[model samples]
Target chain A: MLEPGQIADLTEQLDTDDAVAIIEDLEEHEQKAVLAEMEPEERAAVESALTYEEETAGRIMQRDMVAVPEHMNIGDLIDYLRKNDDLPTEFWEIYVVDPAHRPVGTCQLSWILRAARDIAVSDVMKREQTLIPVDMDQEEVALRFQKYNLISAAVVNEDGRLIGMITVDDILHIVEDEASEDVLLLSGAGEGDINEPIRDSYKARVRWLVANLATALVASFVISIFGGAIEQMVALAILMPIVASIGGNAGTQTMAVSVRALAMNELTRSNTRRIIGREFRIALLNGGTIAVLVGIGTALVFSNPMLGGVIAVAMLINIVIAGFAGIFVPVMLDRMDQDPALASSVFVTMITDTMGFLAFLSLAVGSGLVSF
Target chain B: MLEPGQIADLTEQLDTDDAVAIIEDLEEHEQKAVLAEMEPEERAAVESALTYEEETAGRIMQRDMVAVPEHMNIGDLIDYLRKNDDLPTEFWEIYVVDPAHRPVGTCQLSWILRAARDIAVSDVMKREQTLIPVDMDQEEVALRFQKYNLISAAVVNEDGRLIGMITVDDILHIVEDEASEDVLLLSGAGEGDINEPIRDSYKARVRWLVANLATALVASFVISIFGGAIEQMVALAILMPIVASIGGNAGTQTMAVSVRALAMNELTRSNTRRIIGREFRIALLNGGTIAVLVGIGTALVFSNPMLGGVIAVAMLINIVIAGFAGIFVPVMLDRMDQDPALASSVFVTMITDTMGFLAFLSLAVGSGLVSF
Candidate 1:
C-alpha cells in the first residue's frame, strides 16, 4: 500500500538484491518510477538486475557478495570483514577466488568460525561446489540448489568469474512456482494466478479450451463414422462414453506420473525403456480390473452378454492405448525440448478419446451387435 | 550404488544428520546393521533422529546447532565458539536462547562478522524469526520455510525448549516430493514413483480405474434415459462426446487452479467468493468460445441449425455447471480437511460427464430437435 517514494526509501535501507525483488515485479512504468525515486547507488543495482531476462540466475542473484582471495587467513578475513561497512548486507558463505577472479573454492561461515587463525583458506574451504551460471534459468538453478542442499552459491559469469550469489530464500519461491506451475500448465490454466486480470485469465484459458475443442472434433469424427451403427443400436451410444471416460482417466493418471517424473529428471535416457515397461504393466492390471467390473455391469443392464464382452474388450484395449499414449506423448515433447506438462494433456486426451470411441464402436460393428 | 558396508564407511565421515538420511531409507534390518556398525555417538544421534515419526520436523532435524545467550558480548561469544570444538557442521545462523533455553532471537554469521567486538548479541540479533515445532509435519515445515524464506530454523519441543535445527537442504527434498505429490494424487496415481514395486503400482492404479468405472456408470445411466432421442437422431451421439469432453477439460482446468491455490493458501475464506466469481466468469468465456466453435462446425457439418443451436447452448450450460462444480468441490473438500487434490478430480469429472450428457440430450428433446 506504500507509494513509490516510500518504497524507494525502503529500498535504500535494504540490500540492493532484496530491493530488486520488490521492484522487478512491478509494471515497467512503475518500476521506472520506483527506480527514479531511489538513491542512485541502489537505483543502479536495480537497473542492472532488470537487464537480465526474467527468471534467470542473474535476475534473482544478489550482486553484493564477499569474495576473498585464496591466501587470506581466518584472522585477516575477520579483520577485513569488520573493517568493511559496504559489504553485502546478507551473505552466508564466502567465495575463495584465484588471481583472475574465478572461484576456486567456497568457505561456509561456520567453517571459517571453527578454524584456527593460521589456517589457509585453501586448506579449509571445500574444493567441490556447485557454481550457477549467470544466464541459467531460475528453475534449473532451483533444482541445483535443491540437489546440492545449497544455502548460498556463487553465481559465475561466462568467464567463470564470480559475479553474484543466489541464496536458498531466492530458490524457495521458484520451487513453489515451478511445482505449482506444472499443475496449472497441465490443466491448461495458464499462470493460474487468482490475481490475474480476468481478460488475461480468459484469454489463456479460452485458447486452451479451443485447442481442446479442435481435438474433441477428432473424437467427434470417429463417432460420426459409426452413425449408422449407433442408429441401429442405441446401447452402443449409451456404453461408448464409458469406454472413452475410463480411457481418458487412465491416460491422465499415467500422463501425470510421466510429466512429474520427467520434470524431476528421474525418467532419463538410461531408464526410459524400463519406466515405459513399468507403465505398460500397470495399465494391464488396471485395464483388466475395469474390464471385469464394466463388462459384468453392462451385460446385466442390457441383458446382452455379447454387448458386454465387446464393451469390456474395448475398455481393455483403449486403456492400454491410453497408457502408451500418456508416457509417449510427454516423453516425446520433452525430447523435443518442449514442456511436457504444457501440451501433454491435450494430446493424451485426443489419443484416448479417439481410440476409446474407435475401439468400442468398431468392435460392435464387426461383431454384428450393430450393423452399418 | 555402493554396498551397505561402503555406505556405512562413507557415512562415518558425514554428519549424523546426513548419515541418518542414508540409513533411514534402508530396509529395517539393513538400517539396524548400518547403525550397529557406526561409532556409538554418531549412532546414538542417528538412532534418536530415527525415533521420531517419518516426515516430521524432528526426523529431518539435526541435533547439532550453536545457541548462545542473549547478553553475551561478540568478543566473549567468539572466544566461546573458538573454545568449543563440537558444533553443527552446517549452519548459517546462531539462535540466541533465553535463560530457560528457549530461543529469543537469531544472529546471522554475517551480522556477527560485521559487528564490533564490544557489541552485545541482542544488539546484532534479528528478533523476529520462524520457529518450527519438533513434531510438526515436514510438509507444513517446508511450507513455512518457503513462506518465510528461512535457510535454517530452530525446532522447539512442546515446552518451547529448543530441541534441534532444520536446515534448508533438508526441506528441498520435501518441497520437490510435495509438489510432485499433488500431480500424482490428483491423477489417482498413488506415489507415482518410477521405482515403486510393480505390485504396489498395480494395486493403487487399478483401484482408481475401478472407481472411475463406477462413476462412468452414472454417465451411462443418464445417456440410457435418452436412448430414444439419440437413436432417432444419431448425430446427437456423434456430437455428445464433444460437449462432454470440453466440459471435462474446463472442469479440470478450474479444479487444478483451485486446488493449487488452496494448497498455497491463496484461496482463503476472505477471497473464496472472489475466486469463485472469477472462475464463473472464466467459464462463461471458455464455454462461450467453445459453443461458438462447436456450433458453427456442427451446423456446417450436419446441415441442421436447430441441432447446432441445441448443442451450443448445451455446451455453455454444461461448462458453466462444470466451472461451479470444479471450484465448489475442491473448496468444500478443503474445508472438510480433506486433501482436495486426492479426490476432487474424480468428483469433478463425474459431475461434468453426467451433466454434459444430461444437458445436451435434455436440450435436444426440450427443443424438439429429437423426440423421446
Candidate 2:
C-alpha cells in the first residue's frame, strides 16, 4: 500500500465521491494513497461508505442480515446455529425465493429463531408481500416506508423481478432535500446550499432583490400621489410606515401558514374555504388587539386623537387585506402550476405596502384631518 | 385468526403502536371488532405493520426471515427447510447465533441455496455482522441503515440483548419527520400538521404578529421625527417608503438564508465569517443596482436631479445595513442559544425599516433637499 502521505496527496486532488470511486478501482497501495491524502472530513464521508455501491443496493443497505431457505430440520437448525456464528445480526426477515432468483415469500427472523427449524421456508414465508419499486421518487419511497412501518422490503423492477433493494437510509436524504427545497423556494432564494458556488449564489439572490426593487417602485409611485397631504400634515408621513409594517408582518405570518399547509397536503379544495374563514377571524381578533394598543400610543405620541383614529382604522383594514392576500396569492400560484413559494413574498409585500399607503393617505385626505 | 374487517375496525381507535399492542391482547371477537371499526386509512396503517412493535424491533420489522443452526448437515439443512411450517416466508440470509441469543455470523440466501447443505454452518456462516441499537434516534437509525445498505437489521436493547428488529420502513418515517420539523421551525410555525387543533394554530401565529407590530411601531416613530421634512417637501414622504420597502425585502432574503443555513448545521463558527462576507458582497452589488434605478425614477418623478441623488445615496446605505443586520442578528441569537429563526425575522424587519426611514429622512434634511 502507498504511504499515508501519498494517500493524502491524492485525496486533495479529487472530490470526495470521485476519490472514493477511484480508490475502489485502484490496487491496495493506490487506494491507501488516496484515502490518506483526503482530509479527515472527506475521508470520513467516503470511508464510511466504501463497502456499498455508488448508486446501488449494497451501498444503501446494512450488511447485517439473517438468512435461511426452504428446508431444514428443527433440531439440526438449532444445533447448527448454537455451535456456529451469532444470531440476530442486522436483519428484519429471511427471504424465500425460487430456484431462478425470484422471491416467493418472507419469514421474520424472530419467528424463525423462536420456532423449530424443521419447518420449510414455504411454510413460514408470508404469502402476501408488498414489493417496492426501486426507482420511485425518494419522497414517495419514504412515504411508503412510513405508511408501512417496514423494516426491510424487497426492491423490484418493472418486470416484477427483484433487483437490488432500497433501504431506509436512501430515503432519509430525500426527505431532507425536499424539505429544504421548500423553505428556500418560499423565500425566493434559489436552492440555498452552502456547497453552492459563489457565482450561483449571486445569480439567485440578485434576481430576487431586483424584483423586490421593482415592487418597491410601485409603492413609491402610490406614495407620490399623496405628496400634498404629507406636506400639510407632518404626522401622516411619520405614521404611514407603521400601517404598512404591521400589514406586511401580518401577511408574512399568514403566507407562511398557507405555504406549509399546501406543502403538507393539508389545504386542499375542500378545506380552502374553511381555512380562509378561520384566518379571517383570527386576523380580526389580532388586528383589533393591536389597533387598540397602537392607536392609544399614537394618540399619546402625537397628541391628536383624530390622527390616532385614522391610524387605527388603517391598521384594521390592512390586516384584513394581509390575511386575504396571504392565502389567496399562494393558492392562485399553485393553481397556475407555479411554485406557491416562488416570488410570493415579493407579491405579498407589494400588496401590503401599496394598500398600507393608499389606505392611510386616502383616509387622511378624505377626512380633511390634515389640510394641504 | 381475526377477520380483515374486525382488524380494520380495531385499528381506527388506536395509534399505530397502540393498535399493534391491542392486537396482541384481544380475544378473537374483540380483535375483529376493533379491526372492523377502523377506517381505510387506519386499517391500512395498522395492517401493514401487524408484525412489529410500536417502537421496538417487532413493530418496525417485517416478520419474514430465514434461519439455520450451526450443526445442521448441509444436505439436511436443505431438506429440512423445504418441509418447515414455521419458517419465515422470505429473507436474504440465515443468522447463526449462540444459545444466549447473541448473533455471531450470517449466511446469504444465494450461498445457501447454491451450496451443499452437508457443509457445516461453521464453515459457511460469515463472522462479520453489524449490530443495531434499538433506541437510537430515527435519524441516526436511518443513517446506519443507509451507511450499511441493510435489508434487515436486528434491534438490541442496552444489555446487547436482541429486543426487536428495524427495517427500512421505520427509518423512512424518521427521516421525513426530522426534515419537516426543520422547515416548520425556520418559519416560526409549530409542526404544521393539518390535524393540529385550530387553537394551537392561533397560539403559534399570534405572538409573531405582535412582535412584528412592535417593530413596525419603531419604524413609525422614526417617521414622526421626519414630520417636519415631509411637511416641507411632499416628495420626501412620497419616496421614503420605497427606501424602506426595498431594504426590508433585501434583509428578509438574507435572514432567510442565515436561518436556513443555521438549521442545516451548515453555518457553524468555522464558516460564519465566510458566509457573512459573501452576503455583504451580494448586498453591495444589489444595493448599487437598485439605487441607480430608483434614483433615476425619483429624479424624473420629482423633476429634481439633486433630490434623486440624495435619495439614491440613502437607498444604498440602508440596503447595506439591512444585509449586515440580517446575517448578524441571527448569528448572534444562535450564539445566545435562542432560536435564530423564531425571532430573527422581527428583528431584521425592525432594523431595515428603522434604518431605511432614518437614512432617507436624515439625508433629505442634511442635504437641504426639502424646502419649507
Top TM-score hit: 1
**For model 2, how does the per-residue alpha-carbon lDDT over B64-94 read when each residue is reduced to its tens digit?**
3454566775566656665676554434566
Runs with alpha carbons beyond 4 Å of true place in candidate 2: A1-141, A150-166, B1-178
lDDT of each: 0.88, 0.69
Worst 10-residue lDDT window for candidate 2 chain B reads B51-60
Q: Each candidate's iRMS in angstroms?
A: 1.1, 5.8
Candidate 2: lDDT of A27? Answer: 74
Residue A51 C-alpha lDDT in model 1: 87
Tens digits of per-residue lDDT for model 2, A139-222: 445556566655556666567655444444445565556666767776666877766776787688778877887788788788
Question: What DockQ do the predictions score, one after another?
Answer: 0.78, 0.29
